[model samples]
Target: MLKREEVESLVEKPAPQFVRDVLEHPPFRVTPNTTLETLVSYLRKFPVDVVPVFKSVFSDEIAGVVYPHTGLLIKSKKLDVKIRDFINSPIIVKESWKIDNVLEILASEAKWGAVVIDEEGKYVGVVTLRGLLSALLLREPKAKSVAAVYTPVEEKKSRVGYVKAIERLSKIFKKLAGGEVEGYVVLNREGGVAGLLTVWDLIKSRRWFKGGGEPRPIFGRGAARGEGRAVGVARVWRLMFRGVAVASPDTPVDEVARYMATTGLYLVPVVDKEGKAIGAVTAWDVIYAYLYGPKEGREDVEVKRAVEIPVAKPQVEEAIRLRPSRHVTGLRARDVMLTDIPAVNMRDTLSRIRKVFLRTGSNILAVVDDEGRVVGFVTRRDYVTYIAEKSLGYWKRQKGKWLILREQAMPGEQAKVLVEEGTAADVMKSEYPTASPDTTVEEIAYKMLAAGTDYVVIVDEKNAPIGVVTKDELLKAFKERGRSVKVGELMTPADIASAELFSSLFSVIRKINAYELDGVVVKEGGDIRGIVTVDDLSLRPVEESLRGERLVFFTKSGVLRRVRAGLSRLRYSKAGALMALDVMRPFDHATNPDADAREVVDRLLEQGVLPVVGDDGRLIGVLNKMDVVKELARVYITYAMPERLKEAERVEVKSK
Candidate 1:
């Protein structure tokens, strides 16, 4: 837990100036005509996760940002599809805006990053979550212990045995997707921590399948061709990555956060002296600590100090005056409720519900009767759970037939058939929470959180569903409440993985996979050499393709080139012979520990990770986009609706 003095000091820090002070130059932008395959290859080679889309290479007006992971999930052979087809509107912010205001905007927008423009609306650069976190770490003072912030193991309730069958893992995953559990802690035979699993691991495992379809088996000499067979019968151990980074209860919160940010692993298991998992610290836990201070009897002091410091009497009075009233003055269910979400009938098939969800992008839908009165609620998670349970039943009754059916079924037809067999009534929750059209947003938020439901139906006097309010709408209503916050108050301490320059490619790959890292810093004795990332390895695509595998070679001019090699020869020879320097790129991006957080945010927007350097130019820490977003979310929840936080705390305690 943070000492009283430390908490006070954090609470008193002043906000940074404006967005212009930390503006970054856009690293690279692409035209809308850029192909998905081209973008994938570019992302593989570069560290950037999102690329800004312009009408053309020379045009100044922005289109949107393209995230490559979504495109990677496309199972179709149409790699030549234009990026315009995958674009999402970018969150636009101005360089002249104050830092507090911009922070509120980004937090409310809930995007990976926001695009920055000048007074003339000309693109200047981008500010990303990573950059925000890097900026925050630069100004951070004393650190707090993980025990002060980590969610206890008992509260997670998503554990699995390493040897559990693949069929049984789906239920736990469904819980995770539904927000019923935080994450899964995989335990070994002796009950020791074996590994960790999250939704990302599931996504990564299905990368070979296009659009959640059947696996495409690759055939070649020395190539593993039984991937389809393995998927059917593999144990949890096959999907869970080992060598997970762990933390003790006493470890500093920032240290664990830094490891998570840089390594791409969000949850770190908290183990005891006996190496048994006791609890877990996630990015959210760390952010909550930064915003409201430690959970161990210190939040009162922190919240009081934070509220009194930046907010003046007039602002507080105004806030109180503007608070939602039962009679009038603020938004109610009718004002914020979404009326366009599709409704399903009790007799509707899961297949039709799935189609409606896909078409509308709405997670929650109302189940209505022939009279148009809502009887229950169904969610995307319900459909997912139903399919998983159905698959498990099929595997138990006709394991041989199921495997044969899977192999013969068209890409998505088998899954469709499973859903078609079930009706909406089979998975609907009849006791879902509901609210009147006149209910205030405050009441609605409290109801949803307290009831552990994502949405509430807004019904008419006759009990007919008219509109619905989900967490998103509630958040949107109070998005502008955050103020006087800075990046320094949110960033974690830097702790990253490193390897020797002479390390074999095989050893490096093993280390990367074990830690689930995007890359590692390669160094010589007492000196830094370069960095190597998953993009440099190019193992996934090569392993998936039946054609010749490509080996990376650097020219004398330091340019990277790919040379095709036979699968057998490449597999047997390169593992031991190749070295880190053979594929490593020169490390160029670095930020000062004393610089404004915006500078780091700018750098991070351009580069996936930023290395923090001290006055002496030695590496101090690293920051990534995921950790920054977690911090931003903390700011959003705490400041946007301060009055609701106390009730939220009660809900969390009761749920535990």
Candidate 2:
């Protein structure tokens, strides 16, 4: 409806902000020759919501822009395809075109977003529907709040002139007395919005940068480099075709650990309705979550649980039950352990204890005196060193015979022969990192990282070992905590059938993810055996497609395909039945696809069954089995959850 002259005036009045003005251009533009793996790095570095794909026709002019979201060339599993193959016509708009016209065109097409040549048919700045909408409806807090505007690294402040945009936002907020704009998002030289400098963002940034504390060189440098490369890479991997696995707060403790070991993901973002990211569960957090998490219903939790144990000394079945009694205890040291016991003495000759160690193969040998208290703990590494030092003749002479001696060994000789050695008094590190039984799994993890140890002996108020914490035990705890709870009570006979251990890891993971339950129970012949946690499932590796990692799958009316990484906002189907909104929910703020395939695995671990939705809101691929596991390792630790969840329900809830 606008005339050319008017449009020209509009474009010219604003003046064409060169690519340098708005584009972030730090790592520079990627060419068609770039590989997809490298391309993925580019996207991650820029942090640009999307990256710009380009084909060079000449030295200066761009042939077209590749919509990284929709472009398959960037995601081709082949990794050898020329990036130019994915090029689409650039959605160009002249700086002179009225913003209103640009809006109108975007609205009409609904499909197209990028605008290329302007009314004068000359190269102009690019514009997207969401960005323009954000610009036009600047006053709508909800809209702006929901629709965060981000630019690919190749198109950030360095490429285009967004100084004007920042100025505008600044002025509006200034006029409103610091109340108009929530905060201004600034793109770094590479084009991605480097960080949300919201008032909150500003506070956090200042605290981090200006705190005048000892600095971690690696963290600081990597963070800066990451921001610079964010923009270019942002748009490049727009599709984020992969899926996520998730679980609920109430999932069992053991199952979460299993998922982590199996899936190998560091964290899983927790979400709620509206698909907003709420909180996150990391591998370490899983252990603490289970130990410190509320256990009103989990009173019977344990590892290597004793089955059919005679409560009152019934007729012994083969003298004794070989099964180690499983005991679910609190998070701290001494809460779930046996304390008083005779222990190996470091002063004794290695040969004397070798027989005992050979018999038990217990990794930890607590060195104590006649008082029956722990002095030092020698682990398997120590014994390995002792064996390695022995002459081959000694082993050959001994053969299967056991040797026992208590001869004195020099301190220096012992130290040289032990992998890690100390006297009963010196070698015993804090047998138990002091903590209450009520401590949560989240809290225990921080303590472990700080203490630089994997094993934490649980203790009572009296500082005795009620339980022992080890890497394997924590792994189980992490797996269990990641599994959310089911609508019904667990531990009941009827509920035992719904446990995950009875089903394939994939199916249980899906149930944990779909139903948002804790963990699935393992059942052997209708009896609860063990459970698979989110971490266990997440750590399990699976086969993948060529493009990138596949998060989940979809099958409706006989179609099955994997989810891609960059195309998080899209759903692919040969049937052509999926809608844009379905894809958008996972990426864009409007739809809020809170849980991805990774998160779904967490859900399945908790619940016995998972719920899925596809076209017409029908169930699609259950996201069970090896499919979701394919992309498990790709998940990172610190990525923020979706922004649309209630505070009390997310991972942050524990922090708060």
Candidate 3:
């Protein structure tokens, strides 16, 4: 029983302090004379965005700023260079300035952090977007549930299967890596949460045969001597993490965040009382909660306010004129859609579909009719499931049980027959989400989530597919709404996970799995040779191997060697052994350190990780989706929807 005025007061109460309250005192300082090598060491020890540079140790006078990313970019031979040679001008702000004013300055000028000064212009401390957002979240009242910010299980495109499906590891790998989803949830026969499987599990399970004597060479040719079974052959139950951390829908957002931060877990499955996964609470969700508060119910106050207040005729007209009648401001589907995606005819054979998927590295493709009008969509999962079913049927014809197939052999002939005869229309999904070129990114995001799809086909007036927007494009648009941070500011250190040119494939797989990395840079003599990603390891090779095809191998003598083997026989190869040149994509898709993070996101949408290069063309750092998401959370806290709209309008006006 609160009065109307009291409720209004509660809604309009002044927020807590934002700028000075979140000032961060850096652990150390550097002199302008510090060597690039010294700065690199300091950055490694203390992972701060920016380190203050002073004229001397005793002097409080600020010079410039140096960050870890730029320091790492310095060539090994040039480590002796002084810090002054590559310093960035610091954005200075007074402690007395209001939060909004500071935010405006930071949003427009600073890339990573700003130098805080007192009224007398003396250095006080430093303030980063992340620090400010953390302070704001800490001050916020804790009443919201994790559900308010979590991505529902449907939206995550999570695949659920019985624990007994552990034998279908090869098929599972195809589903996991070939689509938007990254993890799989294992359930008991009763549909209770049993375990979890991820790409890390697949990579870690890869092993070389140690006990088996020399394998017989195929066709009397040199075979991979120590090559063992493929990760696809490993039992899923053995590879999957046994226990899963879970949260309830009603769990407090803060509590979930605390657990994730403490346990170093990025995703927590939200389950019901019956132990059924309903959704997932990820670190990004917690960040969203902290920045935007609750996801729903905020519009109710605005609606009520509009109803209570009397609008003047002129004001009403002005509001109507200003409101967007169609698509809202910001990025639209046309701006982010991919026009070069592969499409296939409905009558096309499954073999053609498989070739297209492997050649283009696409998870989904449009299925078109005689008139070239899109009739449906076919995904990697669809193809794999179809082939698996055929194989199972063939095995049953032999009076065999599914359990026996695990220890004996897969029915490769059945899968081959389906690939050679089955048509796209046999397995294509007809009902899918659709959008127009003019649709806003926000609307597309909702459509994707509602439809539980990774992509939405953008169609023309005739319902012909013109372009397609995927989750990667939507994520990029969301990132653009945040502060325009630089790629260098958000990228992770590259040294943590990397591979040498001649390193064993098993070694590379072990490194990537141990670090849970999407990819690792391949370096030769301290120079980047190329990059390898989980997709490179999982997509074409595993699919081709599972089909029992003769894998072509190139010998060091430039001779063509074709080995009719499965994944098990090809496991023990060097990084540069089997089509390494073709396996690794060229490193030409790199971005400069000073490039906008959105640019990095764009590149990462195609490449799992993007290299950040310095002015001298040396690799600085690497960026991924998670890196951008972390910074996006901080930017959301700095600017609300209204502020973002205003900024967009300003840009539009300038464009005009």
Candidate 4:
């Protein structure tokens, strides 16, 4: 390790950095078979930022990554899953890449860190996004221009609403996905921004529903008030309770970046004199300021979706009445797109990327130029690869064999200064996924499934990104086309893993990541008693002072009234105490598999997701809004569009 003097000397000399210099040898070792409870304890013990997962204690084969967010989920039992499914793919990089090249990879890829490998592709250590940013930001301190770095007046897009349901928010997500919008904004009746909402909000709500809080679990509840986010009601105001943070068009870019680095707030809403939201800025936009210059234009898309109620022609109405449910047609990618176009100019800097990650919670991003043309793309996976490769370079230079640990939070204050100074053109991937507005729903669906991405950028004749198509948007398009299908035809299977009611909340949360289901069935022996979701696993931290000296356990054998009387005693930190049954939602809200798909979909949108049980009365699957929409799309594609395509092709050929 370098001494402060050495660090100072290296700074003065402008010495190059390698992956080894910043590689963190994950302090904890984990395997596929590790229990959620054990993993939670390990995380608590290690108290680190990220952890590497191996196939097992004895195997060297790498699996995926467990981030800090995972730890928080574990504490709340929202991410109950096995170690295997809980981790994300590790970004890998060669050891020989230069520091600049490595930084480029991390930035363009939008990753926090990566696994390092040597010439033989052997694991060396891990390198991180923060480490790289610290080095760069520290080295280059003159990266002013926060105003220029943010989204231009027209490009900032965050969906703002008075109050809406999860279903409504989902629609916004699909729409804004094209614009590459990061989150949804809830405004007061005065049009003043109240709070922000992202997909993470849903995930957090899932945990909160279970009576869980960060680092601890609270049993005995009636869905605590002020916890926000009402799933049953269409009103959205119930979900947003946090304080709003606002920014203006003239706020300096560096100030915003520093705010993000310290507060973890990546998306800041830009408001006018009346406090109505105009645009939003993210950490990525600030970082891009150092990398790219600016864009000139009025935004080409609507931030709020327009409700264009089409007048029905008598012939069209008759045709619609006569058409089969599966024969729905006439919708295109443009019809479903929000058209905000999520892209940054080529001159944007990489330093402000952390804000982007937090704001959008997405790994993939589109890079554009002054003309709003899509020029490149970036993803977190790419950065992981760069970090891995650079670590080897550092290892070779140091001739060292020790693993670096997160306990030594590095890339210190110096690296950050330099990173704030780097440019977006220095990192973005010139090659990326793109689509055309005229693309059909079926075609777009196949494209997304093939690419394994949720969204695709839409470019115009000049190839400038004008919109995006996402799974959510595709679902919206299909629903508007209308459909009649059986619930059995399109539900996501709930046969994913389950945990006993008595299992530690850790075990239930573990199943979340391990199985990839938003929620899981809770069983008491052979009988299903309840369901647990990530929403139930989150809570505002308990006032530790409210906790008593001893643990209080709840049992079903006692009368409900008696148990309710003794409810206040349970109290402790999130990691050590808590069980799945404690955070599981009671066996309420379920539907029969034979219900009409539309009814099921309406139920999903109106109330919330529910379990689908077979005639035998066993939980078989889940019917959510997405499931209904996906089925709608699949049916239309199978029976409706091929002939439409053929007829259109015939017309084109005749014209030619």
Candidate 5:
């Protein structure tokens, strides 16, 4: 409304409460014409996963963001691949934007780096977490909650596998995401950390757009069974950035900080001398620890100290309890109860329950009563088992494709009805442990170990739900004991079960189940060749063997009956190639007997027991995940809990 000079004088000089503050130092940027080689080199130079893409050299206008991880995911080559092929249009912003809002974008799992543009759309500079942290160094992170900063990897997260497409690893990642899953831990065949894959690495997993490459041929491995076919899925071994870097618990915190800062790693896994991952530390953990750790318990605000123990105590009573407890220490029902539980209602449908799963990103759901008291428990696996059983029942009733079509075509059909109507009350198991918050942690640990459950619920004085105690928490209770333990000490050393590589799949599955073993190995002339898992054989039968028109042509529009399917020409295409060697993918994980108990437990926590190697690298024993839990529970309660009790008493007295 005023003259230009008057308006300029009246309006105060612009100040930045946004990325422009940290971007005062002109940040790094790439151009759409940047080659993959040069772009990758630039990315390595900066401490961020993504780089801003400018429109051109002269304009300095930001077009989008380019992620280096995208390059890692592509298997095809365009001889002419350039930055333009992958840059994502960064959510545009103004020079006067608020940091709180901009942070929402930078904090997203899908986004970590963004380009800041002037109101005119000119590329101002790029802002990243690294820059944010650097700008934030002068301000103490005292108010940040403990969970936001601490990164701990209980023994279970150390599990790893050979590189596979992120799709193959999605289910496991989902299960882990429900809890505190340490992203993808890639291990070579020998069970050593190889490559790491985090959620960010997977954000751009889309196949190179319209990228050139013929579909990989199935059974291209020169199998004796399939003369010509395509069978295999894409793997990410080549795509995964390799060279694992691990730290030890004793490694100085500063050293870990420096390592993470330089590498731009969010997670730095702690490894033992033998290269077994034992724990993990995050970059933020170091920042919070150094800048604000000393200000804990100041009474200004609720503060979670470096170790927010599962069992928190009142300051005065807590210090007193740390002293010796002369009273009898029989474990009660409350100490280890789960105080926080994620639950759904009884009448909730599968679709509704799934909503809760997505929102919370958890696998387990506790069904509760009107009073919020524990009533039942459910997990992602329960839904799968129920669906599989229901499908089996339907298949038993409806025999063929024609019947399946009719049943699926209409509503209120036979498949529409279900026992319990797929309600929470139907799928939830009511046979879980319940206790007050005061129950002895030992009792709960024993129950968890015996029932093979990962958690137990905690109720209040009014019999209402309060919390939940998980297996990982109990593992923390045994933290000190874990340090002194060895895998050989906890595992039941047993002979390795085996069969020849060329054995029939049926025979291999038989041995795997009959021996009640973790898994069996494929051998050649008394020498170890590879490993096989039970999962390889339990898949759908060979009826749908041939792809494209080959099988359809022979079956005459799929009219061939189930019994007659074997007689069709499709049977000759690649059906019985299900020999053990051909059907089984080589086991990608393993551990040695001398490895630490924590590392071994991490591997065992996954579905199968890893092959226990001797110094000579021959399988000698198997450490089942459940078996380890059982043994640890017994030893930990009888041995470890008592010591913790003593320490608790001592701490209690000191506080008093």
Candidate 6:
């Protein structure tokens, strides 16, 4: 329960002229006359998510918005010929316009955010749906309403050693108990929000499982005294380390929050598990989800204000209801995970390790073993501290392999100088944290902060690493993979969770965002069912269709890349055909199964004038790029898009 004034204080008011205006110059503005290739490069270099495409002559007037997706499309085709080719007409509004007016336009457009224009009709800034909602939450409410709270749960927390668990749990209780939540539910093996126990529940309950258990050290010291058996499982695992509540990749945050209110739980785990921990959802996550669009309510209806009286009413008469249809949009792991995340082998050389450390803009690298499981991590400071402590001679004299130069290496010496075992099994941080494929961006961020690790390992059910995540990867995942794909493909889907939608989404997103992937596929019964990208189910509203479109483009690009590769392979094979063909077929010349048709053909053609040398050789089918391309063209034209014009005569045009 929050006071109205308290909520109001958090809401951001309309941007004012006094607001540290970036009016110095509106960053970079592109015109329709700009070449598409140049535009693509421009956008890539610019930090702005969008570049305003203004019409020529007017210069100040915005004609359309050019975003990365559209730019990528043009660039992929080598058709980034001109900006006018891809400009999209966008509805523009002024900065002075009330937030309510902006909301009306957004609802109608079915868009997540809007572009802001200045009085001169020049593009100035953009307003997001969430930014506006945050502002609204600050306004006076009709009444005080009870809502749920959300928190992230680490799917596979570094086996929090017993001692650390106790310490961390103690600190958690001290920090979380007195704050916002009424009572938190402890999730159990069933993946159900079990036991609505609160601080008050602990205080008032008279029964103790262990004989005469004391108040403060609920499970820490008690287990030690009680025959070495773990005691107070609830307090130790559930109470201290919160279990992320479950959510589906498609579950609406409003619905989750409403469910939380009914259950009196703060978080919902978005799991792909049948029944287990995966990812998490929170009250605030839902709030932000709704803040972006109509999925929360009927977003298009306009509000009419009482100008004569001091009344602030929404322009639209849409009702806000917590229902199943209120799906979460603009949220996915792709929106947040970092892209081109750094990774390393467990047995990488110290020199290489040092290079990666210095070269990477990020602070850490995901250290994976031969099997690709994350084993350990190395940080810049870790290396820096080692260098400060160790002598140069100590690293130079005592090593066998060039990869290993050490006078005498101490165990785990200066985290950075240590040799990677190279095997996926060795040197990687096995005792590390993880997030499910469907974990929300916010949840992953919290886990990364709490765990104090930049890289998270994405693992499958058997604990095999699928991908690696860093803070930067998480951001990229949120931006790209957030819309369509699930955690399974995006993450290393594991039998980590029982087959359940909620568990699947939670676990997948957590893993994807934690490890920073496009998104993860949700697994159920040890198979992929759905995909959760950082972008698909998170704060950014990049669409799933956009992802598919991108994949199609990439697939097309891959086809081209693959074809070029095949051609290169063909060229190599062409030169050594005779000798290699003889090696492949040691037995019969006429019966040989491995040979080049072109070489054989040339031999036959030349043999008409000169006697054929009886070399032991075999002949395979002859095909070349020109022949293949010709066939492709014929087939493609035969089945291609229907033409309105009359069919032309079928003629074969021989190539020179």
**TM-score to native of every candidate shown:** 0.36, 0.23, 0.29, 0.35, 0.32, 0.26
Give a tens-digit lDDT track for model 1, residues 1-656. Answer: 99998998688544335676555543556888887656655543333324678898888788898653544434434435777777888888898886556555654444445778989889977765434433444344233666676666565333321222233453454454333343477776555566666544544454333332345355753236433322233356666644355666666565554444333344677777566667777655655554545776532211000011111112222212222222212667888899887789988865566556644556677788888777788865445444433432211101001111111121112122121246788878888678899877666665564454567788889876778887556544543232222333323333334566556555665554433334566666535566665433332222111123454645323466565533321221110123564445555686665555543554554444555556676555544332343333333234444656877999999999
Instruction: List candidate 2 segments past 4 Å from native.
Output: 1-60, 66-89, 94-101, 107-112, 115-125, 129-656
- Candidate 2, residues 1-656, lDDT tens digits: the string is 99988898587233222221221222346666656545444433232222345455244366655432322223223335565555555555565565556545543443224534445665444554323322322121211100011111233221112211123332322311222222233333433222222222222111212222233234577566542222111221121112234333333333334333222222333333332333334332332232234222322222221122111212222211122222222343333333432367656555445444434433355676677666556543334333322311111100011221112221112111112222334334434464556654434443443343434555677875555444333333434433332222111122322442223323333344333232333444443333333322221121111112454423222344444542322211101111111111111110012343333434443332343333343222232221221111011111111122454467677887
User: Which regions of candidate 4 fall more than 4 Å away from where they truly are?
Assistant: 1-18, 25-30, 34-51, 58-60, 66-80, 139-143, 152-185, 197-208, 211-245, 295-656
Screening candidate 3 with a backbone cut-off below 3 angstroms (N, C-alpha, C), the clashing residue pairs are none
Strongest candidate by TM-score: 1
lDDT of 6 by residue, 404-423 (tens): 32222211121123232123
RMSD in Å for all candidates: 30.3, 28.6, 30.8, 27.0, 28.9, 34.5
Comparing 1 and 5 on lDDT, the stronger one: 1
Off by over 4 Å in 1: 1-28, 31-33, 76-82, 97-110, 141-143, 152-192, 196-207, 210-236, 264-266, 295-656
- Candidate 5 has an lDDT of 0.47
- Tell me, by lDDT, which candidate is best: 3
Q: In model 2, what is the error at residue 101, expressed in angstroms?
A: 4.1
Q: Weakest 10 consecutive residues, lDDT, candidate 5?
A: 394-403
Order of quality (TM-score): 1, 4, 5, 3, 6, 2
**Positional deviation of residue 548's Cα in model 5 after best superposition, in angstroms:** 17
Across residues 1-656, which tens digit of lDDT does each residue of candidate 5 receive? 67898987787544335666755322355678877656544433332544666788766666777654544433344445677777676766565686556655554433545666788777666655544443343344443433333343453433222233344443444432221333555555544455566533433333222244443445555454443323233344533434334444444444444334333445655545465544455544555554555234422224211111121212322211122223223444454344455689877766566556545545478887677666788765455445434432111111111102111111111123112236788778887766676666555655665454556667678865567776544544444243445666555444335656566545554454333334566666545566555322222222222111122111212343232222221221111113444333345576776777665554454435566667777766555543444444554455656788999999999999
TM match of model 3 to true structure = 0.29
TM-score result, candidate 2: 0.23
lDDT for each of the candidates?
0.52, 0.33, 0.55, 0.48, 0.47, 0.36
**What is the alpha-carbon lDDT of model 2 when measured against the actual structure?**
0.33
Summarize candidate 4's per-residue lDDT along 1-656 as a digit string, tens digits: 98998899676545336766555566668776665556656643343334678877786678877654443233345435576656777778776776666666655655556778888888777765544544444343333443344453354232232333334443453433222344556665655556665433433343323434333223334344434233323234554433434555544455445444332334666665455666666655655553443434321221111121222212212212222345554777788865643455677644344235334434355676788766766544332222222221111100011111111124532122211223456555565557788876665654554353345667789887777775446655655665556676666666444555556544444444333334567665446776655423321112121122232222222322211110132221111123553345454467877776655444453333567877777777776444544454454455656677889999999999
